[model samples]
Structures are given as C-alpha cells and as structure tokens.
Target: MARPLRFRRSPERWTASRVHDQLFTDLDDNLGATAVDPTFRPAGEWETRRFEMDNDDVALFIWDDDAAYWMGNTETPSALWRTDKYDWGEVPYQVARWAQRELLADLHEESPWLEPYPHVSWFFLPVFMSKDGRHTTREFFRDHAAGFPDAGRDEGLGFYEEFLSTGVLDEYRDEMSGKLGTSPQFDLVRMSSAMAEFTAAKLLTDAGYQVTPEIEVTTGHSLDFRAAKGNHQPLVEVTRPLPPTQRAADTAVAAVRETAETKTSGQLSEHGGGAVLFVDCSSFHDDQWRAVRGEQPEVRHRPAVVYRVRPNGHAEGYTKGAVPLDLDGAIEWV
Candidate 1:
C-alpha cells in the first residue's frame, strides 16, 4: 500500500513581521510624500513618491507590490481593506505588510502551481498606504527584490504563516481533506504461476472473445476460454501461484521459459486462435513482479475505462491512465 498524501505544516518564523515593517518604512522613506495618490504617475515619479501616504493607501500599494513580485501580472483579485483610514497603529500595518511580502516572495520562488499575478500578490495590503508625515506618492522598481534565505526550505513555513494570518489554510483544509479522503482506482496486471490458466482466458477476452472459468478441454484440465469469431489457436497461457519447488540455479531461466512459452503459444494464426497462459501466483512472494510482455491485468477484472477515474473540477484528460496511479512497479505492455 502507498503512503497517504499529506500537506506538511511546519514551524513558524517570529522575525517575519519585523521584516515587513522594515520594508514598508524603507519604501516610504525612499518615496517621500507622494505615495498616497489615488491616481497613477510616471515610473520615475512613482518610485520617488513611495506611493501616496494614507495608511489604507499604503497597505494597498504594498499589497499590489507583493502581488506583482510573486505573480507578475496575473494574480486573482482579493478583497482590500483600508486599515490606514482608521487608527489601527503602525504595528498592525507593519505586521500585515511583512506577512504579505514574505508569503508572496516565498511562493514565487518555490511553487509551480501559482501563476504570476499581473500586478502585486499581497493578500492583506492594498494599492496604497497612508503615513503620518508624507502626502500620498507612488513607488515602482524595475527589478524585484531578492527572496528569503533557504527559500526552498522556508517556503512551506512562510506559506503556513500566511495561511494562519490570512485564514486561508483553515478555511480551505476541510475542503481539501474531503477530496483526499476519496480513493482513486487503477489498473492491475497480475502474472504468476497460479493464474496461467486464467491468463489464457483473459487474452481470449482481449481479442473480443469471452471465456468462463468452467470450460473443459482435451487435456483433462479446466481450460479458461470460449473463443468467439472461431479464432482458437491457443497462443498464451497465464499461470498464477508459480510452482514453488524450483532450486536457485534455474530460477531466472525457469521464469523466462514460462513466459516465453506463453508468448509462443499466443501467436495469432490464420484461424485466429492463439494461446496465452494466465498464471496465478497470489501465494508467491509479495515483492515479485509478474513478468509478461504486452499484457495488463484487469483491475478487479474491469476495463480501464470502468475502473479509473479522475478528480472532479479538473480539466478532462489531465490524467488519462488511472489517475493517481497505484502500481507496485513498472508493468510494460507492448
């Protein structure tokens, strides 16, 4: 059995908030007073103003910057609040900015799923910020700032912080968990000494014929077949529960001989009859792979279309052959 897929949450960082505060102040000091403007300005003037100075406006600006930093210009729109309009204190503003910047930066570097936001990717901040002394001005940089240390390792941590602060993680976890709870189906191909007779029957089915487990043949052994279209030339035999008495010397050759015999017997003839040995080795070693070329076992004896299904809300064809593939090892079918 495979291990369950998990969303590994990690420890948080305490200094992240401090980092946000520092960036906001640095941005404000560099741009002077024009950072609070509701209107847009030239690139040069925008950089000098650091976005017009309203706290609400400052949050919006930093938020926009963060979005731009991570998503480039394609981020989804999120609700923006004008905390700067109230007396929420500089601490709140700094904390919010810090969290947003860190999350965006981390995500941009580490995740493949996230698309670049056309503008900025900040979750809490807005397109503007209001400060005590300066008039609202704009701020823009041609190149983005660098990301955090060991960003690969820190990204999960950063995202978790953002999740807690933004409340996205808790709100989304239940939904994600429900989806994970559902198990996916896959194709199974079993080849062993015991199922050899069964394999012969299955190959007949593959060629558009049907076979029942009770059919008797000339050899006095129960043959697994009822060939249709008058195509009967005994081509392959699938055996399960391979005979366990073999010594170590011929183990490899014995298996090869068994497999080769099935293939040779399964040769399509003018009469359209072939033989395939279906061996059932269910009682054999768990780690063994049933080695057969161009053959796949039915998952619970159902066709791939009937057994495998993709997740809901995903684009069709994203997963074709048994989505969330559950296989012991590579099964070659030529």
Candidate 2:
C-alpha cells in the first residue's frame, strides 16, 4: 500500500486577549504589569511590574475590545505586532520583510548578526524626570538591585574611569576584569580626520561667527558677510577649477577681491582683517576608498572630478572669505 499524503497546519497565534488573561491569572509570574506612572504600579512588590495605563493614567489591565482605538498613556495593544504599523487590524509582513533585509545586508557583509531572525527584548523600567533634570524614582529596590553592585571591579582602568563611576560592578568583578584585548580594526586615522573636521565646524559655531558654506567669486570680486564681527568681510572662493600645479595665486586673490567688491560694494571697513579663503576638497584618504570598494566594488572613487565656479560664484564650504576648518579639512567658520 502507498503512503498517505500529509498536510501541514498553520501555527497558532499568541493573541492579545490571551496575553492579558494570562497576566491577572495570578501574581507569582513575576512578570507582573504596571503602568508608566508611579501610582499605577504599587511602590512595593509591584514595583518592577510593567503595565499599561488607562485614560486616567492609572496602571490597569482592563482590556476594552470595543474601543478598537489606541490612545495616549495606554500600553501599545498586543495585536499591534500583527498589524502593518503593529496595529491590531493590519498585517506586519512588510515590516518583517524590512527587518529581515536589514539583517541580511549586515550579515552577508560578514557583520556581527549571523542569525536568521534576531529577537530584541526590552525591559522597561520607569524613569522619572524633573523639570530641572536631576530627579529619579524607582518602585522597588529589588527590581533595581541588579543595577547597583559591589566594588573593586576594575584592575587597570584608563581614561574610561573619567566617564563612568568607579568599581560599581565589583560583585561581578570576575566578569568585568580584563583588557579591551584589541583596538577596532577600522581606519582610525581617517576616522580621526573626519572627527577633526566635524569638531572644527562645531567650534566655529560656538565662536558666534556668521558662516556660509561655499561660494564662487570672480577675479577682483569681493564677498561680504553681513554680520562680520570685526566689521571685516572678504570674498570666499573654492579651488574647484584651480589645479595645484597650475593654480594661479594672483587669479585666486583677484577672484576673492572681485567678489568682495561686488557684494560689499564700497562698504568694506578697510580697518581690519579682509581676505579670501580658497579651499580644495580633493584630498584622498586611502582607507575611505578601500572601505567603499569593499562594500561596493562597482563604484570607483572618482578622484579627478573637478567642480567649476559659476559666474554668480555660488558654492559651498566657504565663510567670510576664510577657511577656518578643523583637522578633517572641511572648511568651517570661526
């Protein structure tokens, strides 16, 4: 006799009603529910319990299926995980697909997550905030007990001690003690350069200077900044069309002067500092090029692409006719 054909059945769903019913089924689950507010969950045994809040902001699990609506201060409905937006009525296939694709992209690139489906579990603890930003409240000491431990944890601590409190993880000293082992394998030099550029721009902003991105200036044309602190303004130009070997210093100077003349007109304060800054953003970092290629081999680094200055002299990466930039070399103000 031939074997009988077999059929597979769909999996059962963990419905919201089921989850809610299970919660009040009794206290020993330790997964007790509490509302976001202090009064929602009791200050004692219920301290660590997580719950959804009602309209009154009272932490209660009174489920109302008829309302069929989501409101502020309420726990997100369990059915939300099923919906497209994680709403009860919609399907979340698209969201699931996106999550999968993201995971795959990283994994295929030999990144950290190699598992097919990654699960993220969040433990929500109520955090209290005061208007002045210096107050905190917790429901129970036992629930927060893990956060505070013994002392003498770190052996050879370095600059990190400046950031975190010392020896707090002493109870878990065995797990905590150790060297960092190795530095990150990424290109630290290029990263440092990029960080420098960002820092420079930030410093300029802190200095209270009115800065502009990039602008093109013609020879003998001067650019003017409206709020030049020292009342001195200069035309700014970028060396897009200028080559290092054949760059004309006179032409560059003339272009800035012309920009200043056209924009500031006869208003230049002739009193203090007034000059142009011309920058070239063509520097090549071997690491960045290699990294990009490793990710996408088809896209070659275009080192020869040159930008041109228009007749209007509008561009980016210039301010007050000076390139006040940081280590990363991106021109900034200050």
TM-score of 1: 0.21
Q: Write the per-residue lDDT of candidate 1 for residues 143-253, one digit (tens) a residue.
A: 101011112323422332332343322222322222112222211122112223322332334345434343454544443443443554332323332323433323432
Per-residue lDDT of 134 in model 1: 12
Best by lDDT: 1
Residue-by-residue lDDT tens digits, candidate 2, 1-334: 1111111111233335554564323321333334332222221211122343222221222122222211112233443423322221131333223223322332334322213212110001111111110011111111221111111112111112211232222222211211111122322223222222222222233344444432234443333222133554333322221212232323433332343333233322232223332322222123322332233211011111111111121112323222332212222212
Which segments of model 1 are wrong by more than 4 Å?
1-203, 219-221, 230-236, 241-253, 258-334
Q: Candidate 2, overall lDDT?
A: 0.24
C-alpha root-mean-square deviation, each candidate: 22.9, 21.9
> What is the number of backbone collisions in each predicted candidate, taken in the order shown?
105, 33
Root-mean-square deviation of Cα positions for candidate 2 versus the true structure, in angstroms: 21.9
